[model samples]
Target chain A: MSRIEGRFKQLAMQGRTVLIPYIVAGDPAQDVTVPLMHQLVESGADMIELGVAFSDPMAEGPVIQLAHERALASHTSLSSVLTMVQVFRETDATTPVLLMGYANPVMHMGYAAFADAAGAAGVDGLITVDIPPEEVDGINSELQRVGIDNIFLVAPTTPEERIAQIAARASGFIYYVSLKGVTGAGNLDTKEVASRLKLIRKHSDLPVAVGFGIKDAASAAAVATVADGVVVGSALVDTLAQAFAGGGDQAVALGSAGKLLKQIHQGIANAAS
Target chain B: MTRNTEENIFATVPDEQGRYGVYGGKYVSETLMAALAELESVYRMLSVDPDFQRQLDEDLTHYVGRPSPLYEASRWSDNIGGARIFLKREDLNHTGAHKINNTIGQALLAKHMGKKRVIAETGAGQHGVATATIAARLGLECLVFMGEEDIRRQALNVYRMKLLGAEVIPVTSGSRTLTDAMNEAMRDWVTNVDDTFYCIGTVAGPHPYPLLVRDFQCVIGREARAQSLNQVGRLPDALVACVGGGSNAIGLFHPFLEDSEVAMYGVEAGGHGISTDQHAAPLTAGSPGVLHGNRTYLMQDSDGQIMETHSVSAGLDYPGVGPEHSWLKDLGRVNYVVADDDEALRAFHTLTRVEGIMPALETSHALAYAETLAAQMTPQQMIIVNLSGRGDKDIHTVAEIDGIEF
Candidate 1:
């Protein structure tokens, strides 16, 4: 099984919801990314979402967009993101690393070349925000051949018919956008999320990881009820941005982000118990 | 002057998934796929719906001032001393441009689809003004995204849009031009898909958009065609139109795609010149890449980073054209040309002085191209130039360039 599918299965058996913390690789600093990947695991992350910074991230909100800008300012590229995954893999082999970003950078690297490099770097999956399943020809099969999960997003507006179509090729848990807006735009409506997840479940056996509007421990915990995994992006990225902006020292900022992740972890576990 | 047959492929295009020979597709974020699909279905239903057509026609005739005259520019043609020139007077349309045609058609579709709000991105502010006018007419809320740079350049248009009840939000993103405005508009659509209808200004974006915008603006071609048949004994020997995101050019070219005898030219904005890195002529200076949700020729570097494009006219400052234009370029059907800022300015002044008509800088690109092409052809031949807009909005830019202030 792919690392993502395996992790989801393991979490399912344990009756535990997966906590996925998204951090932009090379955000604020290049060396900080690998360390942050390790820090996420220590803070009880089930999987690591390493954002590959691109010039234009259409699906992103202001927080994530700023994160992308910071990462790109640090001169981060696809190769650099893969190298971070490699460094993280040296210490942690069990945790799956999903590279999340727009499709242009990956397309620039060429599908076969990127897939090969990603596999070699021990990357587990990819979330190309701009590449819908209908336009997945060049990269999807190539990524799958190298054992990388091609994760697709299912939105609140996604109809049942398209949900089934997306579910067919999707792996490593579908990222269900909790709201009908960009990340960090507004609050999540858990009841609406639950209804959407129900529809998504009818089409795929894969785990559903809810994201896009999950802000804090309460929101993440509420989403963990119906979702198999919870993704917190803008909030975590915002935390990193605060640290990089001299709001506090690196250790304090990282520790505080870890503290927040720990709270989210406990909240989900508390709900399950 | 030599080219292969365009292969009756217009009918077979955008197969099941809205692709044009591996060009156009749903290369958008997954959240937008459902919305695009829903739009495609609605458009498909309304495409042949006679009720929808009747409403659209009524609005076009009485509201937008459709069947805009095909004026034979006798004075300008006599001055050029070449081909007899005809101007497809889209400038005479309500709101002073052809943009109202697409905006009105889309606004009607927005009403038909029960959307309560409409949003659009603008560079020249013509599309935004057109959209806001229709939205106000239909009682739908309207929002327009304009780049900070463009809002400053086209301040008159910004005021006009505001007067028409559109909230003109300034986009302060990369380059801060039409491309950035489009990005902001896409974000808005993704954010408010429930009540918002994105009235895209041109023939770009993912799937049904290029097709939808083209069909709406084809009223230009349809009218010009019938008008030419009645005015002249035969079709014009050559057709010319300016291309930004290429809505106007595609609108005028799509109906004539099958007319093998008619030659077509699409003018791109040559900001400085093709040799310099300052121009926005993507078809001539750039290669194929994906941007703004569709695969097309792009002003992007090797790293897939979109390059900053330049143009004297804000409307022609985009780094990409519509996907269908890319397809047509590959097929060698339409001859894509360029008009540098200097040449377009010359055409702008010449038309204003010789014919007493001030054309939009965007439309002047076509006029500039047609002037040169007409100077070579015989007077017996005819060329129809799609005069896409009026220059009242551009008078400030022109005045500033001439070292005069209001």
Candidate 2:
């Protein structure tokens, strides 16, 4: 089984909700990412998403957009992000690490070549933000050939027919954007999320992960009850931004990120799975 | 290179996925796919709907001042001592530019769809002003995204949009130009998909946008085609228009695509020169790349980052061209060329002095090229140039460049 499937299956047996904490790799410093990836796993992250910085990240809101700019300023490219994953893989093999970002970098690298490089770099899954389910068949086959999970996102505006379509093609888990806006732009309506997750569950057995507006531990816990996984991205990225702005070094930023991830993990753990 | 492919050139376009020979696709986020799909369906229904066509046609006639004149530049042609040059006076349209054509159509569609607000992105502010005027007329809340640099350069047009009650948002992003404004507008559309309709200014963008915008703008070419036969006693031997996102050019070219006799030219802004890396002539100097929701030719660096483009004309200061234009280039149906800043400026002056018409700097590029093309052709032959907009918005830029105070 794929790392994402195995991890989700393991968490299902343990009756635990999975916490997927995302961080743009090589943000504060290049050398700090592998250590941060390890720290996230240590802090009870079920899986980690390593964001490869692109010049234009349209799906992301201001917080994550700033994180991307910071990461890009340090010359953190897709290859560097993969190298970070490769380094993290030397110590831990079971924890899933998904490379997530826009499609242009992959297009620049060529899909087959990128799939091979990502597979060689120990990437378990990928979430190309701009490519939707309809446009992913070629990339999906290429990634699937090398055992990489193709994760797809379903938006609030996505119709029922499209939700079924996305669930059918999706291999890892469905990232249900809890709000209609870009990531980190608005607040999540948990009541609306719970109602939508039921609709998604009716279509497929694939685990659904709710993201895009989960701000604090309280929001994470509420979403964790309805979702198989909870992804806290902009919140963690915002914390890292704060730490760095406060003259905290990369070490301090990663530590703050780790502490927030742990608290969010704890919140998810406390929720009824 | 392949002339035999003409049979299927315009027949099987878009092919259900909105691709024009692998040049266009929905290269957007999942958050926008449904909206696009919804828009495509709505467009498919309404584009052929009699009532929608009636409403749109009525607005084009009464509101937008359509069937804009096809005036022959007799004195300018005589001075050039060559081909008889005719001008499609799109500058005479409502809001002082060709932009009102597409805005009125989209605003009507937005009204029909029950959308309460419309958003647009502009560089020269002509489009933003036109969209704002239509929104004010249709009772929809309007917001226009223009780059900070563009707002500074085109302050008068910016003030005109404000007078129409549209919220002008100055995007302070990369390059602070039209491309950045477009990015911001796309972001806003994704964020507020429930109530706002994106009234795209050009024929570029993802799917139904290129298709729909071209449909709205093609009235220019359709009218020009009939006007040519009526006035010139025959169709013009050649057609020329300035290409930015290529809405105006495509509008004038689509009706002539099958008229194999009518040679077409699309003039891109060569700010300095293509060789110097300071131009916006993507079709002339760029390789194919995907940007802003479609695959097209773009002025991108080796790493796929869109390059900063330069043009004296803010309207044509874009790194990418429309996908249809890209397809047209590959098919060899339309020849893409460039006119540098100085050349466009000279045409700006030449037209004002000879024809008593002040062309927008964007249209002046086409005027500049038409001068050379007409110079080469016989007086018996005719060349029609699309005067895409009036130059009043560019007067300050022209005056400042000449070191003249207001």
Superposed by TM-score, candidate 2 places the C-alpha of residue B257 at a distance from the truth, in angstroms, of: 0.2
Worst 10 residues of 2 chain A by lDDT: A53-62
Residues A48-163, model 2: lDDT tens digits: 98888777677778788778778877878787888888888899998999988887778777789889999998999999888887678879999989999999888889899998
Chain A TM-score for predicted structure 1: 0.98
Runs in model 2 with CA error above 4 Å?
A: B1-8
CA lDDT of A127 in candidate 1? 91
Sliding window of 10 residues with minimal summed lDDT for model 1 chain B: B1-10
Considering every candidate listed, which one attains the maximal lDDT? Answer: 1
Q: What do the candidate models score in CA lDDT, each in turn? A: 0.90, 0.89
Per-residue lDDT over B1-406 for candidate 2, one digit per residue giving the tens place of the 0 to 100 score: 1123446468678778888997888888878888788788888899889999998899889988889999999999999999999999999998988899899888877887789989999999999999999999988999999999999999999999999999999988777899989988988999999998999999888887899899899999999999987876788889999999999999998988888888999999999988899999999999887778888998876556678899999999999989999999999999999999999999999999988899999999999999999999999999999999999999999999999996
Q: Which pairs clash inside model 1?
A: none
* A131: Cα error in model 1, Å: 1.9
